[model samples]
Target: MRKEGIAKRGEKNKTTIRKILNYISKYKGMVLASVILAAISVVFTLYIPILIGQAVDQIVGPGQVNASALFVILKKILVVSLITAGVQWMKNHINNRVTYYVVEDIRTKAFNHIQVLPISYLDSHPSGDIVSRIITDTDQFSEGLLMGFTQLFTGVTTIIGTLLFMLSINPVITLVVVAVTPLSFFVARFIAGKTFTMFKCQSETRGAITALTDEMLGNLKVVKAFSHEQEAQKEFEEINERLAGYSMKATFFSSIVNPATRFVNSIVYAAVGVIGALFAVKGFITVGQLTSFLNYANQYTKPFNEISGVVTELQNSIASASRVFELIEQPALKEETGDSCVLGDAQGYVDMQHVAFSYEADKKLIEDLNLHAEPGQRIAIVGPTGCGKSTLINLLMRFYEVNSGTIKIDSMDTRKITRESLRAGFGMVLQETWLKSSTVRENIAYGKPDATEEEIIRAAKEAHCDSFIRRMPEGYDTVLGEDGGMLSQGQKQLLCIARVMLCLPPMLILDEATSSIDTRTEQKIQNAFAKMMEGRTSFIVAHRLSTIKEADVILVMKDGNIIEQGTHQELLAQNGFYTQLYNAQFAR
Candidate 1:
């Protein structure tokens, strides 16, 4: 079982490497050039030590030294060294470009994939975790990938070049150096395999910490209001402690590769030294040749040390790359093709038949539901929390697809219609307001990105937010922070209402849209919405029953099933769930 798990992990690592190589291969011409430069640089670099050895051979004794020949050899060595340096610099420059390009591609794919994922998937996962995969994990992958691209080829080429050069010098001593090199491989392999799992854990925990911090900080106001600061801190500390533990373990194990490979390599160096000395003393090879052989031994073993370090980076890279690939490869929401039906000039008709949907398969939320609404009808959905009121809006918007059933808009099945065209036909305003960091004019124009300034001000006035907008220092051009910084909750909600008013699509969905405003402002916005809803099919999910009393039909729901349906007066006369709900609100 243990062996099988390891084998699976090895296979996964290979897949990660293959995917990364595919991205790198897109710039293969540059990669090939860098590799060729690396090989050329290694060749010149290897020749320098040989030239030095020849210069050493020229020094027979102090008085017998070949001064002119020595100077010529020295000059040759200088020229080769200079050539090696220039080639390596060019190789490194190309490598940097290729590495960052690959990172950019991966990050782009990850972010694009997120946009197409189903709302269910987004709801199931933390935004911070997803953001970490796109930003932080990709960043980590790039660092490891950069290190690999920068060092891997050069280290490998030097090792092979040194080995060939040593073979030419004296094959017997070369054999001795080669014999102890396996020890370095064994050490690096054992440590690297363990570190991959550790580093992967560390990466996941970093994502968890990012998620926790995002959640805690995003709701810091709520946390302070509830006085849960200590509890939040404790939770953060627990995850942070876990992250530190994972990082320490991963770093410690990866750190071991350098020294461990060096230690094993030192033994190889010692063996080469001892054997080269014997070969020198036996007159099988000259002192100068042995000097070159020793240099080759050091060169060969040095690559093993450097490569061991690179392997550690490659392990972390593969781990991070796997995470990024998982996100990019997640099953995206099924998309509409070019031939998909488009909703053109929707008539505001909606029909839901035998609808059965659930966020989780084992737990049903909405089931066997049926509804019909004519164009221009106001259908008020009234229910307590978790009664599928907002969920019905979700289904109607196709944010969450019905598990089994048909939602027809204008008698065209929603499944057949292009999602963009279908969604474009509706304007939605929810209790939870969202505003990007932009000017007030931009916020109002969000739903209709190309709205004229006059149209924007008109929508703001309709939503009763124009007065506040004019009071700001820059008025329409005043830049707001994310989620409408410094704006009161009611003001932010008003801006969201204005955003929807700007579009005023043929169909509307108002889910507690007026819950945040003062009652006087709520009444004003309701009047504006009433005028806006004159000829559009509107689904109003409301908690304050009085606001929805004029709805053409009121559907009161409980436990995902609607039990009462009629005009508000008729439902009150029924004296059932809707009556208790309506009277309870007014009673308070």
Candidate 2:
């Protein structure tokens, strides 16, 4: 399993690298500048050794020291150092700009892509992991790009220039230096390959820790109520331990890379010195030449050490990039292809023909279902838990596609219309009301951003929440806590209804909209819902029979099929499934 995971990760890394490179292609000028600066810096660096050799030969080794020549060489060396510093600074500046913007572009695309993903994708992936990909993985890519590109560009230029200089002095010694290059590369590659798995594991474990922490914080009320503080702490400690263990393994391998490279480099340096000394004594090499060769040998070994360090960084980056790209590459939910058509002055006719759907293939949630609602009609669906009531609403909203049937609005198949156009025709108040941490007025006006104070108040009054809202210190401008934690469940539901009412869509869906309210509040909400449902098509999925008694149509569902359908009066008259359910409930 671990090997398979590593292989899959490697493939993903390759794909991500391609995508990153493609993004970078847009900033070709900046990349070119960086490369040029890097090459210039390396060339200037190579001059330092030559300047030293010239100083040794002209000033320190001859019968008489040449002061003028020494001054000229010193001036040249100073100029080269200054040029090298300036080029390196430019390289860093250009690389930083390129890396930062590329990361920003990728992050924006990833975030936008997430918004268009189907609800099913979110359902399958953990929220924490998704969040980590966006935040942590993207950060890794930024760091990796900066460090990796800098070292890679500089290292290659330095190695090439140094080898050419060494060969100029003594080809034999240069050959010996070149021979060790392959061995260093092989060792670095071996270590990198072995450590890749640890890096991946560490990333996964870190994501898990993030997810667990988020989950705990989100459900802090429940945790406190159950007094599971100790248990939660223990669970967190265990996750932290696992993450630390994987991190340690990854770090351990990374730490070994530099030292190992240095050791190999030390051996190479010793061999070069010994060989140069023997050649010098045999009159085969000059002292100045030997000095130059030694300088080049040190220069050559620097790339190996730098490359070893970068390999570790690259491995971590590749792991992070793989996860990030996986999310970015996920196919977005199929979008409507045709031009968007508005439902202007819509009459809200809806029909579902032989609809079939399943979250998974083997377990069908809604099967071979048929339903219809005329313009300006109110329909209610009632069933036991897991009986496809919510699934039906999901299909109507086009959140999920029907497997073997069609849903249509005014004879237009839903798939033929853009999601924005199709959904714009409806209003929804879900059971789990979601409110952003914003002003109360903003939350109410979410459906209509341009709504005025008067219009917002009118909608709030209709939803029966205006009076209570006005009593608050800040009224409509009051800032809500996360998910509206400052408000009661019933108040939150009322606010959600007000939000929906503000939109005034031709159709409204109330899925357990009254479940969170008390009996008195439910009555007020029912009145508001009735007012909203007037002159519109509406679907109500509720367990409460009283709430749907006035509905134009009621469908009794069981096990993914509608077993009974009629008006509330007609179903009661039949005394069948609907009648039995009504009796059992009222009998309680």
| Candidate 1's TM-score | 0.97
- TM-score of model 2 (CA atoms): 0.93
Give Cα distance to truth, residue 363, candidate 2, Å.
Answer: 1.1
Model 1 error, position 586 (Å): 1.4
Every candidate's lDDT: 0.90, 0.88
Off by over 4 Å in 1: 337-339
What tens-digit string does per-residue lDDT give for candidate 2 at 1-588?
988976876787777678779999999999998888888898889989888888777766447898899899999999999989988998998888998998899899899999999999998888998999889988987898888778988998899999888888889988988887677787898899878888888888888888888889988989999999999999999989999999999999889888888888888898899999999899888777788788889999989889888888888888887888889889999765656565565678898999999999987678889988898899999988889999898898889899989998998888887788778888999899999999999999998999999999999998889999999889999999999967998899999989998899999899999888889878877887887789999999999898899999998999999999999889989989888889988986
> What is residue 6's positional error in candidate 2, in angstroms?
8.0
Error of 1 at 411 (Å): 0.8
Worst 10 residues of 2 by lDDT: 336-345
User: Per-residue lDDT of 301-367 in model 1, one digit per residue for the tens?
Assistant: 8988888988998888788888889888889998786677989999999999999999999998999
